[model samples]
Target: MSVNVIILNGVSSSGKTTLAKAIQKYSHEIWLHVAMDSFIAMLPDGREFDREWFPMVEVSREGEVLPQMTNGPSGEALLLEMRRLVRGLSETGFNVIVDEVAEADTIADYRGRLGNGCLVVKVDAPLSELERRERERGDRLIGLAREQSERVHNGISYDLEVDTHAQTPDALARLILERIAA
Candidate 1:
């Protein structure tokens, strides 16, 4: 079977993971859910991900262009690895559902490195609504929101935009399926 890589990106509380789960549930193919954040969190040695480290390594003098690393791992090491995993999975004929921030730099990296045969899905929610959800979910949601806000403000683009502000996960999944069909 030809691999279909589904990428989910968006602001915090955007329901990317939720959408990924829905896709896995509805898709007839053997879909694999790969989450960069979850993989990084699973890293051994009990090392917590340093959120502020990117702006440090990736910041530039012009402010016009925040620098991005081309070296191993770059500022977004986990994401880079996730992209690599996607490439490998595609090569192996596995349908992959990737959930990440999908920031501009990473998207460029993916385009340059991963080639074609993939779908980019962007999930979005109002900042205020996201913030409220963040406050409600506490640490996990708050951290996710912080990363998502930074990514979106930094200017990220996608092939499909899914707004999950009021829709159920199943509804969002149906929308994504229809988009993919189109």
Candidate 2:
């Protein structure tokens, strides 16, 4: 038997994870939250100190704060595995929800990897709201969301787009479910 897959792409603290959880809770079928954060957490101990993906921040000419992401061999390999995991799980009839912080190039890669069967949702919040959530969460880089906001959704054709600040996660999940049904 086949199952559904949902890829929720968004910046940090934009509520992708929250929405993913809500989707899982409301869905009749069991869903695995296979997220980028889970892959990131698998990196070796020193990675967070010296080998982190976004090691630092840079300010753009327009003064937008941005996180600089660098992927060495290890990071790249983990990402490859993450994509494979998503494909493998869904193919084996497990419903999956993936939350990611993906840019245009990354989204393109996913488009090819996930094929037409996956529902790609663009999750976002206002910059102010994103920053607020980031601060409240207290785990992410201070300006990562602001920097990611500049280009995260650029040039991708999404199946659905939801604003976390505009509605509760349950409402957004229902909207996403509706979109999937359509």
Model 2 is weakest, by summed lDDT over 10 consecutive residues, at 48-57
Q: Please, what are the lDDT tens digits per residue for candidate 2 over residues 34-97? A: 9888877776655643453525546673755466555656677778788888888877888889
Candidate number achieving the greatest lDDT relative to the actual structure:
2
Q: Per-model C-alpha lDDT, please? A: 0.67, 0.81
TM-score (C-alpha) between model 2 and the true structure:
0.90
TM-score of each: 0.76, 0.90
Residues 1-182, candidate 1: write the lDDT tens digits.
Answer: 22278878776567888889998888777689988667656654334434422322344333533323222344456566678988888788888888876567777776665566677777877777787887886654344464446545366556777778878889988887777667
Candidate 1, residue 25: CA error in Å?
Answer: 0.9
RMSD of each: 5.2, 2.1
Candidate 2 residue 12 Cα shift, in angstroms, is 0.7
Q: Pick the TM-score winner.
A: 2
Per-residue error (Å), model 1, residue 15:
0.9
